[model samples]
Target: MYGVILKIINRLQRNPKRAATWQYLKFIRLNRETKPLILYPSYFSVFLILGFLMLASSKGLLSKDINEIGDSVAGLSGVLAFLWLIVTVLLQNRDLNLQYNEIKDMRAASESQAQSLESSQIFQTLEYLEVKLENISEYVRQRRNLIIEELENFSRQNRIMYNGNTMLDLVDAMDYFVVNSSDKDALEFELSNIRNDFTYQSYLRIQAIYLNIEEVVVAYEALMINVPENIKPQVTKYINAHKKSLMVDWCDKMLPYTEKLRHALMRAVVKHGIGPEANRHFLKIFAEKDG
Candidate 1:
């Protein structure tokens, strides 16, 4: 019997909600039990005193006898008072347990909602990363087109010079003159200069292209790694507001070699007397060209 009682107590302790309801029920039972045990006994004591008072009035018993009856009633009433006290104690305990369980349930629900909110935040972060990657890819394509157009403009200018009176190098002369002049000696010096310039510019151009490609890759990685779950929207908003400035900054940081390449191209154009104004006009037109 003791083992069974202990098992029941343990189960009640494990579930506070059930324990609270059980306590409330126990208090109700106590109040019902107290009504009979307290009120009935007190009522009987009152009725017995009244009967004694009436007997004393008719028989003229001593006042001492009446006092003894009063004392006896007081003793009986004390027992009823004790029963009421026990009932009140039980009710207070039950009320406290019920309130505690309500608070516990509220806390559990709040924690569950917080976990769901965190999961939604993580999902949105991944979505933002996907969108940023797509934008970066498009931006990289535009940069590549800009580089190619500049190079194409340079080649077109060289071709125009070759077709005109001035063939500054053998590559240009060969492109235009292998049919007109068979004199191999006439092309040797210009051919050497063309070979040297071509080698140097080719190296610089290749390096610049590779560096720009690396910059795009780094930006993609930064987007993937740096965006926290809750702050992705803010990150995306800033990127969108300043995409052009951000792209220029990324190129500067990741493609420092581009400045040297630009200088080399300028030097080659100047040595061929392409002139600053002509080069500037070509750059403007190249920027306006379709990608």
Candidate 2:
């Protein structure tokens, strides 16, 4: 019997489920309230078995008496089985609660990790865009200088005043001439010829600058759209401040000119009826500006 018990104990020690059950038993033993709940069934079973054996030994029972004892034992067994069933249900409920808590904790952890990853990606994208914006700003600065130089050279060759005068000023002068001339039709015809000639000559360089500025604006819009609502105000403020600095730089340390050359070119195109292409460009610029 001792050897059989030892073998059973060894088998239980090797079984993972049995080891877990043993650990659970130890946990229940640590709790004073749970200890009796866990041990009561075993205690009752042992005492009932000892009492039946003693009763059977003390009396030589008749056949009818044995049947009565058996019926009582069967009824007691049913009650005992019901008690064990209740204990089983309670244990299962505790296990389910533990599992539910674990799942909740894991879900919270996963969501936090996902949010952190998204935030990191957003910041990386913003840094990349900032660098791109800076490069575009530098390119625009160089192109603006080149355009000014070319304009000055053209003015010198044509013997026209270039200093302290903008393209808008030239347009105003032409408009004034056309408006005040007694032979209005003739003056208007002469001015139309000048406008067409000037627009054709200046179109390529002016268009290049306009396209670069459009790229900057497109990137700014994309940046705004992709930023999260929680941090949008901070991002917007930073971008606006950066843009102000770039605008100052582009204006060559003077007050910001707001792309006066481009605007003047567009005005000339519309007023002079350059072509379908120029008209389209003018309309697009007008819509974007208004929007």
Candidate 3:
């Protein structure tokens, strides 16, 4: 019997679950899997007491007297309970330490995965913003080329003319007189008016592009910071506030340029709206750009 108990203890030392069970037999813990061990031992204790009662009636070990049998059973039960309590406490501590180590490893893996995902998101956003900026820059270059070409053509072919009194009119009148031909005055006046109008329009367009680029850069910076999910709400609030500060009058200022760009982009998108074709195009653009 002693050899069997020693072998059981040895096996339990190798098996955490079985060891947890042996410990629970003494500890009476409110744990999920091991608590059943406490109940099994209580039932076994009752059975041992009953067996002692039967043994005294049959004149078995210790003494045939009922009082002596009861006293021996009580003493042995107390000794067994004390040993069980000590063993179980040690086992419970071991289980708790193992659980703590497992939790720490899992938390580290989770943090690493989170960081990798966050790095991926930042790389993608940066690539997208860089491509968008490149497109805007190309558009601005084309638009500026158009304006410069128009200004040159107007200067070569037309003369300035004016009918009213203002600082702008005075400048046009001076240019009209210097042109040296009666037929050129009307054309020059119209050219001057167009140049002034185009200048104002181009200034507004360039300012808007600059502002949008600033917003994109700010958003990219926010994305690159660690723990984006935890800080995203605060970052978004600041980014949106900065964006709002750039331009508040959406009705008078923003709609025309957005409408023109949106229409042109929609046309481009519709032309390449197929499966692998669109995917390949996006990959090529995103991969080649310096984000």
Candidate 4:
């Protein structure tokens, strides 16, 4: 019996409206009227007095003079008071039942809506990632040799020119080839020198790489927008791995004309939309020359 009572009490605590009804049954309360303070005690006193008198009469402890009338009146009044208490308790339970149903329905609806929102976000992410993967794959497949050749050339030139490999060396090379051209046409003339030195080929390779920088930037922006929160870190890490070469290509586009093109590509990212630690290995060049 005690275990059963404990289980019922535990269940009541989990249901707030029903718990309120249970709490009311265990305590006496006042009405909103000013008479409340006096009214509660009066009702309680009546309840106690009637209960005591009824017990006395049942035990035959009442004097014979008052017994006949007092006993009959006590019996009827006690029965009426008990019935009224039962009715009040039932009314409280009914009110609490309405509240319980409302809360339960609201909770169910909220859960359904949240699940729908999560599903929609996931679907969008998958669609965006699919298109992005295709673009990245095609870029790599087409530009793989050009990218490798120029990066190798950059590495070799850096050691010879700077006495050590560094971003400054690469930055200076790009500026010499592209940025410091006396005029826009001068850049075409120098790299297209009449003697046809092997130097022209290298300059052309660098330009080729920079041309793809816009596509890389577009893909980066798309991932940032479309990826969901939970796995964004892993996805970002993978994307960042490829960012190193992109940055190198970025340097090529630093010339006044090239920067305009780069900006155009970044803008196109809004319309065209779109890695890992291999970036860290290459990006150390930039990191080492922060000043």
Report the number of the highest-TM-score candidate: 2
Candidate 4 structure lDDT: 0.54
lDDT of 4 by residue, 1-291 (tens): 999999998898889899998678655443444354345655776786688678767877655567666766787678667766766786678779978999899999998998888777666665676577656755654454454455567657543354233345434444444433455554342323212122434444455656654445555666678466875775666556555544433422444444433233222222222112443343344434431
Decide which is better by lDDT, 2 or 4.
2
Residue-level lDDT tens digits of model 1 in 59-100: 665555778767755765686577657867866788799899
Clashes of each: 0, 0, 6, 5
In candidate 4, clashing pairs total 5
lDDT of each: 0.54, 0.59, 0.48, 0.54
What are the runs in model 4 whose C-alpha is more than 4 Å off?
A: 1-90, 140-145, 156-211, 223-291
Runs of candidate 2 with Cα error greater than 4 angstroms are 1-37, 51-66, 140-213, 219-241, 244-291
What is the TM-score of each predicted model, taking all chains together?
Answer: 0.33, 0.46, 0.33, 0.34
Cα deviation at 216, candidate 1, in Å, is 5.1
lDDT of 2 by residue, 1-291 (tens): 999999978988889799789879977766655556577766787787778767756764334576777786787788779878998898788889989999999999999998898788668766876886676677656544554555555455445566544344333333332333455453333323334446444544445544554555555566677667766776777777766765522332121122444554555666666657756575557846843
Q: Which candidate do you rate higher for lDDT, 1 or 3? A: 1
Of candidates 3 and 2, the better by TM-score: 2
